[model samples]
Target chain A: MNPKVSHPRIKEFEVVTNPKIIKLLLDGTRKDIVFNYLVNEPMTVKQLSDAMKKKPGTVLHHVQKLKNAGIIQLVETRETPRGIVERYYRAVAREFRLGISERMSAYDDDTVASKDRVRAALLGLSTLGIHISESDFEHAHDLLQRLIDREAEVAKVYDSPSNHAFQSLPPSTRYDVSYRMSQFLLSQDALYRKTLSDWHDLISHYLRKIESEMV
Target chain B: MSWPSNYPDPEDNDRKPAETSAAAPSPSGILKDFKVGFTLAVKNFLSFGLAMLGIILITILLLLLIVLFILIPILFTLGLPFLIQLVETIATGFQTTTGLTLVMLIMFLVLPILGPFFVALGAIFGMARELVESDGTQAESAFSWYGKRGLSLLGGGAIHFLITLAPLVIAFLAISYPTWNPPSDEELRVIIPLIVVWIILVNGMLSLTYPGIIDGLSAVKAAGRSVRLACQFPVRVLGAWLIITVLVTIPLIPVINEVAFLWAPIIPSDLLEPYGALAILTLLFVIVPAVSIVLTRIYMILTAKVDATYTQGADST
Candidate 1:
């Protein structure tokens, strides 16, 4: 009578932490590339291999490790040669949280690894910001800002009588407006990230110049 | 609690699954069903337009108020160095999760209650619109479905929330217990089992609750029906969800990084200037709600279709 008893597969999804499980996830290089690519979004193994410049067989090995870890999952698949399938992988969690601060705690002085991670994070952040900032500036900043403000204001009015006016507009129109806003935000973000990256580089250059003078 | 006798008897040797009168709809019949559904949705939309607008407006205002309430504590706690540092890091890493949780809480808990009230109002206006479209004699005022059906709708929403949350509440308790006092290895041993239990409970709850809520059935009755339907056709429900998730996730791949960057401001930043700060705030206010609404609509459409199919089967029986 119990639902759990009735559905055994549901019970099989335990947190797999074993090294063997990790090995299983990274078994093939193709799978590994696919899993890494999916840390951003779901990607077909072909897309993964193409991006990584690796053979499909190689990529599949690593993807299996990610799958076993419950870190990457099959989002979907498409048919290919001889009815072979190509599955898309997506990371299970969107965000990662470290329980303790790695920087503050004592650990191996892997400065190179740390530096690489920091650089990647910074670059990622800067690229995203620059894109958004550019989009924001493209449409006269004031005009776009006003439109956003108006939408916000309209969104605020919640009296009983105005519901008719709200409903009269097609749902698609609302969706269209929202979609445009998201696209705009995305562009602005890209721009912002780029700008930040430039600023960081400039700051670093200046700091180096100051250090040279001090030396 | 037993399977309904009216269920198509698979064991009957004489009758093939395909031979049943209602086993599968003809293409024309499918088209007709679609047409009817579209009409109903349109009617519902039109009649409830004003009420829905009001509900949305109120809901948004309430959300802003809730956000303010949540933020005030953080601002006050910022005076404490430890708390401030913790908040800063969480803000950076968990921006999307925080935003999503806030949005989900508002949508699932608040919207459902307000939604049916508006729907009833819409149904009344929709009937009036139909009469007008037909060139029938117009009455000064139409019968209000809200006045007649408000209680049932509100009751259904209440039941929906409670039934849906039961599993989540249990999962939360299970997950949080270990965190209060760090678990020993023996206690950690139980973690996998607990997680598995939690996933099954959560998924099963979601699969069942949406249909039950839409149908305005009591939680027990809805849950019972859902369990029966899910067990009868496990692959169909799971496959439907899996396919939907994959399809939805595909379009999101290119944009995920962009979305995260846009949302990053909800976390505190020492490096960003006043202008940069303002831009982030503006982005959050404008974009977050829009994205949430679009996603919610997609979910409704998918779940509603699934519910409608079951309703059709029930009607045939």
Candidate 2:
């Protein structure tokens, strides 16, 4: 997110995601595990090491790598039992959406950046419960593409606190946000297509009706 | 392969086919995709190139076996008259009639009928499997997935042909119908427009293979879904489909020309043989599989799923 965008109510900030930082995190398994923890909270090297049951020295190296990539930054200084100055570091942002880039899109084969994106995506495969077939490959490409486009729109609109549309919304005006991942075998293209049309029609009808009735 | 650092024109606004605004990025989008596909293919060029070479040799060996074992015996025993004419013309070495015609017939008929099936199983589908599995460029793995899926390529090719046949059938009836009385200019106008619409409609429906293959849905479901998708995102689908069609077809030019020349025999047989064989090898091994890899990467990008951060407890600050 551009810093110029204001976030009047947000205590925690969001980042559009730096591809360089993501590559650093995904380059190794240990770095991935460390990132998973530090992204959760701002923590000192000892705290991270203890949480993962690893040595502070080992965790320090990973933290230093992230710091160099500008993915993690020092937020505060703490005095420990021995009066040593300890720096608490945190990931630059709480959320990362794949950045929209023409250069990234140009290559047909996966580049280092694209490969990192896939690795990040697979981190949630177990929870997302994904399954794909041969015919569905093309369709899946379309779906993922649309999702990326949609995500970019949301990030742009809500980028700054001052510009956020939902900031001063009344309780009734606020819409709940829901996220889901869908997977289907080769047998369900028709059912899904019909479902898409039905949902669009139903949503439109209700929206029109609601417009006619005063809120 | 260089894309401008900034994506200046998303070109999605007024992108719906129903909307009559801008022409949309359909043509340019497909064109842009080729650069991406080519670079990606080049990255793993060495291994993929070798794999294609191996498949070409295997295909040649298989063709020889088929000719020696099946075609020769069958043609000699059953179609003796055709063989007699072929031998007589060759022995004379003067006129080029029987041998050339037979060769042309084989190239025209066999190429169309079986070429697609071989490509589907051997290259496109095979490359798709390798891509998803992430087995790094071991040449054999690219082709290893060929027989794992039974007759999918054949089945998919049939589905495309069947869909194509719909509008074709309509046009066939409209143009060829015998009528004692000729219609007004208005009737001729209506018939042409109707036939054109049918052609566009059928091609849109034919695009279901991508979604169908990813979903593993039957042909019918894929067809319906593909149409729905086209309706919803016409510009994008049209762009992608156009680009993919061209990329896949370009590889065939060399082989097609070579095959056409094979039957004509204008050049000396010994002189022309090496180049023709090399072209066939390159088409089957290098270009086709590279195209397949490109398609698989596109599919993987579009179809991949990631759980929301909220679900992952990454947002619980």
Candidate 3:
């Protein structure tokens, strides 16, 4: 044992630079498979199918596609009844980075406005043990869209000015300074601030609602 | 990476894999831990800080009571003279020879009772973990394990405390070596620095000892795991340990009142008696909780990658 290197764990992140892999991940079923099921821990086809309410055959097909793309890997296998073996698979990384492009629009219609992103967010919230009612979900979706639009408006106003100043800086300094400037500008933006406040209020209100129901 | 020939089977879900493909440690991750730790500390300052203050005061009272419990009987047997001597010693301050004996008695005799308090401090880490990883935690959660797991944590605390004290005792012994043939100046210089480094390194290695106990390991097992973690991520663990050590030690700086390091002590020395009760208060209120949160945060991050058994194991408590 080297004794210096830490424990055996899957890589933390994988950058999807290859266009083909990006396209493969764009498919809703495969994206769902990676994000909802396989991202954190290994799961068998039977478990995945049961969780997603899909047939094992269909889920296995998507899992195979993901496995072939090198986005997920078979990590373990277990014996089942009748001498059958079930393979457990997990994402090759805990997180996937869209490294090829600044925007995921290359693979989808729209990245932020897309329902897929909201669904993915909800799935993430569910993993955190948060499940909201259908009506609450709709309200959340609307509030999120408003926040997105306000953020876009704020960016449209500041991006050009920030980019022009960033261009004048030395390349090495630009990478570090631009992030700081963007954070500062966002912190000072009123519309963005109000939108964030509204978002916070909505989330906290839901949390309180959940707490009340539990009580 | 190919598995080592002697590696245990990966199919054994009970044990973590002994593979080497790990997430490389980065400064940003440690900084994030710092930011989270400080932020949580600031957010929960009143609740957690007061609780910690209460614990410290209670521990001090318990120690004094225990000392007196032992003292009154001996004093009664010796009659009024010893009582007068104790009062004189206290009035003259602990610098007096008789007072030093009392101090030594408080320090050594109360050692057994000191372990559970460190385990009690583990409660701060517990609350911090809950706030970060799950739903928000209440201040009262700090005492949740007090009555139930008191004995086990006392055992864990004793082992941890002994490991922590061993280096200090060794250093003291080395420095106070027999004077028959005292060591030369050069040898003393090398030995002193080595002892300091050894203390720091030993502490860094055992940084996660309490967290391991909090995660349900026995004290011995926790100490062993902490050493393994230190060996595995020597740089990260030591970096975190040093950062935390420096932060906690800041208020204890001798010149805080003098402000001697500054070109001019712009803030008046009397403004708040710069390093008197204010320093102790800051140490108790701000620094201790912040250090706990930071240590717990780093422990969680490192353990998540290294140990599969860390399903936030202490949550069940």
Candidate 4:
């Protein structure tokens, strides 16, 4: 009944060295058992209920909560008698990792931020993202960390004038953006290939703009 | 791991789906895909059918339990015992002649929605497992990822509904067309072609949705993947759909005629018509299981190709 929790279908969760996801997943014990049982194969709420000795409705509520938290998904659906449709839900992945992607300190305790702050940081990251390479990332890890520090500082300074020389940009000049970052590989599918091509063009256009600014 | 060992460099550039599909080897042809599908259907015909049947029965049993659960409140309200309430409800359904609009509404609109998604998910899981595992474990493996990815599967199903929604809308308009405007042969030009395209798109995507789900893509991504695959190999997907439709339809010719009260001579005119039984038999034994096996096989290939495209992407990167 807590209005704070959103519907299970829309909630995005992260597994990190944090209990936040675990909390969002619901009380630790039941979800732990449910998660463990579901690790090997998919099961309907009924099957899970019978096996766990929980009522089907109770199991369904937990399952939906877990699913909404992005831990589970529907694998298939079918039409039955009349127009009734049944769904089978399964965990999103076979294995669960209770850590961030780096398995480190969840971006060194800086990944957590207000939405607008994170969004602004992400916009900068994405803008610079296209140009960075594996070698560049490795060589500049420390530098990147410094940049992240600056980004955090900037967001922190947004509401207060800076003690340091770094002044927050005016609201008119500030922006927030979010983009899905993935290491896309080229493909043979003409359509997929065209998407990549279009992406490359867009990125090139941005890179050119960056170059112009630099000049 | 987050620090990243690999990332696509700027030179990796943009690549579109058409380019990806085209650069890739031709998809498993419709005939070959059909042959593979048929072989799969034949190989696991009984097991797959039984597995599907098991899922169907299990789902129905769950729905029945749900009905019982709901009936508990009414049972107490009616001053009747639990078992008696069960009997009364069933009796009421069959014996009562007066209108039960609420009951009918729940049965048709609400309850059907509940069961169909789960049932479809179960079949996909089962058939996908059967196709992939090729062992005794396949039957149970169908439910392997059930609780894990419920949303994705739900999303996938929803995406499919949305994809086919256009056709439904078109069909509605076509049905309503004469009401608003005079029917003309020119409408056929648009309607017929539209129907053909919709059929290809819908059927092609239908076959590939599972493959994408099985590959762990979300419903939206799966639908997109299926559409790309369909566009790449429209003929194969369409042909496979045609072949399967024909196979299922061939057996139902007599049943169709019997139900339609048409030119079916297979049954004697004086014979009693178990029309309902015939329809159930055809659907449960033949249509559901056959479609499962065939589509599973087709999508399995498609999923592999889909995977290959990614690996190919990785290699290029």
Point to the candidate with the largest lDDT.
Answer: 3
Candidate 1 lDDT by residue in tens digits, A2-66: 11111111121233344344334323453344334555566655566567775443344355446
True contacts kept of 2: 0.00
Model 2, runs deviating above 4 Å = A1-215, B1-36, B58-112, B119-122, B132-135, B173-232, B245-287, B304-317
Q: Name the best candidate (by TM-score).
A: 3
List iRMS for all predictions: 23.5, 21.3, 18.4, 15.1
RMSD (CA, Å), each prediction: 33.3, 25.8, 24.9, 20.6
Residue B159 of model 1, lDDT score: 51
lDDT tens per residue, model 1, B1-317: 88778877567342122211224423432233233333333443433344344444555665577656766786786656766786686566555443334345545556544554433432333232222212111121122333433444355445545655555555555555545344578976786567555555445434443333322344456456555544543443343334334444444433343464354344334533554555543333322222222222222222333433111111111
Of the true contacts between chains A and B, what fraction does model 1 have?
0.00
Candidate ranking (TM-score, best to worst): 3, 4, 2, 1
Q: Name the runs in model 1 displaced over 4 angstroms.
A: A1-215, B1-54, B58-216, B244-317
lDDT of 3 by residue, A1-215 (tens): 11212233888777677767876876778988887678757776767777888655456557767876899876643322211224467888887765434224343546434546654454346444455443466567666777666556655654565567756778678657655666677788787778778778877877887789889
Q: Tell me the TM-score for chain B of model 4.
A: 0.61
User: What TM-score, over all chains together, does every model reach?
Assistant: 0.27, 0.36, 0.47, 0.44
Model 3, B30-113: lDDT tens per residue? 665676667777787877876786666766876677778877896879877888887686667654433334445555655666
lDDT of 1 at A99: 18
TM for candidate 1 is 0.27
